[model samples]
Target: MNIIEDLRSRGLINQMTDDEGLEQHLNKEQVALYCGFDPTADSLHIGHLLPILMLKRFQEAGHRPIALVGGGTGLIGDPSGRSEERQLNEESVVQGWVSNIEDQLSKFIDFTDDDKGAKVVNNYDWLSQMSVIDLLRDVGKYFSVNYMLAKDSVESRIENGISYTEFTYMLLQSLDFLRLNQKENVTLQIGGSDQWGNITAGLELIRRTSQEGEDIKAYGLTVPLITKADGSKFGKTAGGAIWLDEKKTSPYEFYQFWVNADDRDVLKFLKSFTFLPLEEIEELKKEVEERPEQRTAQRRLAEEMTKMVHGEEALNQAKRITHALFKGDVKQLTKDEVEVGFKDVPTYKLEESEKGLVDLLVEASISSSKRQAREDIQNGAIYINDERQQDLKYVINADDQIDEAFTIIRRGKKKYFLIRHM
Candidate 1:
């Protein structure tokens, strides 16, 4: 199957300018395509996954893919999907974020000496050096205020406000496409559904700016805005964004995010995220219906995605940590496993001169007050080292240390605390 058909079958195609024309263009060989990512944060969240995956698909099909970082556009935020004008970030801040994002993107796409190896570009390289007079005469002449105002991105913000900087964003983005087309032969631009207006603007710019009979053509394609079956936003938990960086989000948490996918959304997620063959996916769907409790589909989904972002070693560690935590088998866990599992739990420190279990629990805020801590201990709602410590007078000394430095404290069934001995 062609790349477009593969994207359609995988549920990745949300919108496209013209599939027939695009497919014809791709069949000609070594077509250059690109997708832009704004460096709005230090790390990309799950929301950035689909477009990046689409770029990977194109590269696998022997097409050249350009991953454009929006260092310039990020300074003037893309107002396409926002209801309000964005608070522009500082130049230094945006530059730092751009560098970090570029590093993270490298983990996903290969940049070696393969024939169709990917390339990275930053819009700031070109956009920052252009002057207002040159921009208005050369690029801005093609766009009209009426056309810009007509877009849903601008129209939605009219009731509140839209800044001049943001309103002119499309012009700058279109120029990026024009520059790439001339410099790199980039013909197709892919992005999220919200970027439809900007993508089409670029395509139009390429058409209008080309010399007579240049025969250059451009296309725009977009992927669906990922959302949960229950209509909540994706890539977010109580802990905030599910980052691609391991330091920001541990492998175990990332695995759990996929493993806990709602029964209704699992199949759809598998298609969009994983590169599993259609036949294998169909078989898994059947297994899901026939034996829902087995959760074979969710486990496979987690394994594939975790290994993709983190390595196989990290995936194995995450799996081991998951099993150990669920079974209360802490003794079997390594120091790294303990750190990953309990990273978010509240922690307290004992100076080797401090008092007992009650004091530690109160200090850690695992209990509301000292009286409450005493009550919890008496009622067997407290555990240390996975063992119930029911006595209020149980003074915790150096003897209570696990691995000679740490204590795992639990209040009730869910709340956990870590106490470190100095």
Candidate 2:
């Protein structure tokens, strides 16, 4: 299938300007497209996945994808999805975040000089040198105040008060598109549905600012904003944002996030996120309908997505931890695996002064009181090193340690504790 058809089949195309004309243009030659990402945080979360995946599809379809780091725009937050004005970040903080985001994006695209290879651009280079007079006279005149105020982004914050800095955000963004179009010949801009207004503004600027009869053309496209079936925000868990960086989010947790996708959203997520062939996805859907208990579709989704973000070694480690945890076989896990897999579980150090199992359980917060601790041990509700410790008299000496330093403690099926020998 062609690029547009591929995007349509995968449900990635939510809104576009003149899809037929764009397809015809793509059929004649490779297109130059871009998507801008603001450096709002040091790491990108799962919410950034849709746009990045769309860029990947574009590259696969023999188009050049430019990943634009919003070093300039990030200083002035985009108010598209927010309910209120955002707290503006410091320039240094935003720059640091921009560096981090650029690094993360590099992993997802090819940056070689080959045709259709991805490229990275920073708007800060040009934006920082722009003077106020030039900006107001040259770019501001093209956008009217009435047109800017009518946008949902500006309209929603009317009562709460949108700052002048943010009010001028669209003009700056439009400048980026104009600059890119002039320099890189980038003809298409893509983003989440919320960016439709800004993207169209950029296209309008490109059209009006170019010399008369210059024949410069640009297009805008957007994908649906990802949301959970339950109406909660996507890319968040109890721990926090599911970061693309493995350090921020372990591979196992990242894999689990996709594996635990709601049944209603999995197919849609697969279409939007993965590059799996339509036929293969259709087969997986049938399998999901026939025997979802096996979770074959979920596993494949987890595997492909995990590998894409974390690489093969990390994916394997995640799978290993998943199997070990589910089978109650912690011994198979490596030292690093144990550290990462149980990082959030409470930990306590067992000093030589601690005399018995009761002291250990109480110290680890495994029980509320000494009496409860003793009762739990006697009732076979406590385990040390995955073995039942029914005897209240049992002492947790250094001899009962794993790796000569630690022991795994459990008060029940779910409550876990890690004890270190000091």
Tens-digit lDDT track for model 2 on 1-422?
A: 89888888887888999888788878879888999999988999889989988888888888899999999899888989788777889999999998899888888887777544679888988999989999999899999999999988889888889889888899999999999898888999999999988998999899898888787668999998877899877899898899998989999999999999877788888888888888999999998899988888889899999999999999999999889778777766766887777889998866683458887778778899999998999888997767788997888776676666667888889888887677
Q: Write the per-residue lDDT of candidate 1 for residues 21-64, one digit (tens) a residue.
A: 88899988789899999999898887899888888889889898
Clashing pairs in 1: none
Give the best candidate by TM-score. Answer: 2
Assess the local accuracy of residue 66 in candidate 1 as a C-alpha lDDT between 0 and 100.
Answer: 91
* TM-scores for every predicted model: 0.93, 0.96
Candidate models: Cα lDDT each: 0.87, 0.87
In model 2, residue pairs whose N, Cα or C atoms come closer than 3 Å (at least 3 residues apart or on different chains), thus clashing, are none
119, model 2: CA deviation in Å? 0.9
**What lDDT score is found at residue 103 in candidate 2?**
88
